[model samples]
Target: MTAPLHPGRFAGKVLVVTGAAQGIGRAVALQAAQEGGAVLLVDRADFLAEVVAEAGASAAGFQADLETYDGAEAAMRFAGERFGGVDILINNVGGAIRMRPFSAFEPEQIDAEIRRSLLPTLYGCHAVLPHLFARGGGTIVNVSSNATRGINRVPYSAAKGGINAITQSLAMELAERNIRVVATAPGGTEAPPRRVPRNAAGETEAEKCWMADVVRQVKQSSFMKRYGTIAEQVAPILFLASDDASYITGSVLPVAGGDLG
Candidate 1:
């Protein structure tokens, strides 16, 4: 079941949520707006405007490729200008692009995985620092994955591992700065079909089998033996981004049904 929205929980705050065109990012943006936040939804997807409309007057959308530092910086600058300053940043841009055995991955494929699943968060954190500092204090919620310890996507796993390290180290470094850094390691989540499939090319039979294996491993590892709903993932993310979790930082709360990945 989804958690109930706490009206005004985010009153007077400005929030930036990446990958907001769909799925968990979409959920967060709408909920935050409903809770009184002025939200900036960022995505390169064509459907971004739809989410912005759904989020109403309190929300706006920015289209940017977060994989590059320039794109990341541009998004942050736009947010700062539009919202007057940003108080919370949810780095929801990363995802595994392909599912296959490590040996089957070409060198370029590995690079793509790292670029997709790591660089956005890395660039986002760096780009948003000045804005957060300007605000006196803020929160950063990185959406990681429990697949870091599962099968078929070694490069993606390595990327999430990097995020885990970033959360820990950045938290300690910024604690004195009044900025909180944290992450949520989500398990297999049952989201609606993607508007933009991660791998645009149609999957070969071999690739399909490999993906099936990944699904199997994910469910088997989770103590609940099932994927979670998108709401289940978004609730904790908002918690970490809210003042309710003011005392929490440098932590990766696993929303993986007891499979602490």
Candidate 2:
């Protein structure tokens, strides 16, 4: 039930959003479609098909593991074949896969954090560039987290930091081509209950404590001292993706209730 307030903001545009099956990704895709954009919703989950159906004729779905280059390639190919070109790319495929103190993390866990929260944005951007270049210009809105500043999830923080760096560097490099690259660093957000959870079952009490600490830090760090609603997070994302942000590039806007991270 996320209706479009800025109708026609994305009219006639073709948008590609990764991680489109749920949460912020799903919200963005639906809002974009409602605003008159043709959306290509991509996710590895089969449930992505349901989101596509919900979008009706304005959107289509593709299944792909966006952490890999092959998955990124396949998604871009599908978009090109179906939509002819991409006008906006929303790299919303990352999340903190685990939350723990930096010292408590295994090396493999560190690697997984980077893979889960960073590589998709890197790979998705790389795969979609050629398509955007072909179209002569486009916009990219990367979803980063305000936890980059306050967290028990150290590895995830680093991954989102990487997102900030890439957003800055890519925006400069692509400016001449009119390809604006920007990011939104969201703090805590409230959404529908997850059909899938990030934490595994049978977590130890110690692990539970660690997760609780993360939640505490997120709220404390926000000036509002509360999590934001899904619509609050979606508004700035859509703004950056829309032509309204044509003059804005290489910037990471924080949508964290005054948490300036």
Candidate 3:
């Protein structure tokens, strides 16, 4: 079950949620709009229009490839133009594209993993800073992962570790500007099947085993011994992005049922 919504909590705020076509990003965009935020749902996926419709009249959609700086800048600029200015940003555009043992990964595959899981958040944060500054200050909530210490995804792990560092360092630098940077490291989450798979190629037997091991490690590491719901992940993210967490910054809250990765 989802948490109760606090109507008007985000009244008068403009929020940009990357990867808003699905999963936790979709949940965030919908709930934020319900709570009175003017939301810009950003994603490159064609399904983004569906989410925008589901979010009602308060939300708009912007399609962009967040992996590039140009795309990130364009999204933020469009948010500013559409909503007056950005008061919050949820950097949610990332995921591991492949699952395999570190030694088994090709060099190009490793590069792709980093590019997929890291660059969006990096570019999003950089591009949104000026807009947040223009709004006088705002909050940034990055969606990191607790899989940083898990098996068969070293490149993705490194990418999320960089997210932690970005949250910390950027918070320190932006505190004086009244801008807060924070992150949530989510563990295994249960949601509907993806409309777009991370890896379009089929998995081989060996790759399947590697992924199974990752699932095992994730369950064993978490006290809950099960995956969380998409609503579970969305609650904390919106909390951090809201003024309720105004005093919080530079912290990476582990939504991993006690696995502090």
Q: What is the TM-score of each candidate against the true structure?
A: 0.99, 0.97, 0.98
Q: Candidate 1, which segments miss by more than 4 Å at Cα?
A: none
Clashing pairs in 2: none
Task: Report clash pairs, candidate 3.
Answer: none
lDDT of 2 at 93: 86
**Backbone clashes under 3 angstroms, per model:** 0, 0, 0
Please name the candidate that would achieve the greatest lDDT relative to the true structure.
1
Model 1, span 157-184: residue lDDT tens: 9999999999999999999999999999
The TM-score ranking, best first, is: 1, 3, 2
Worst 10 residues of 3 by lDDT: 196-205
In candidate 1, clashing pairs total 0
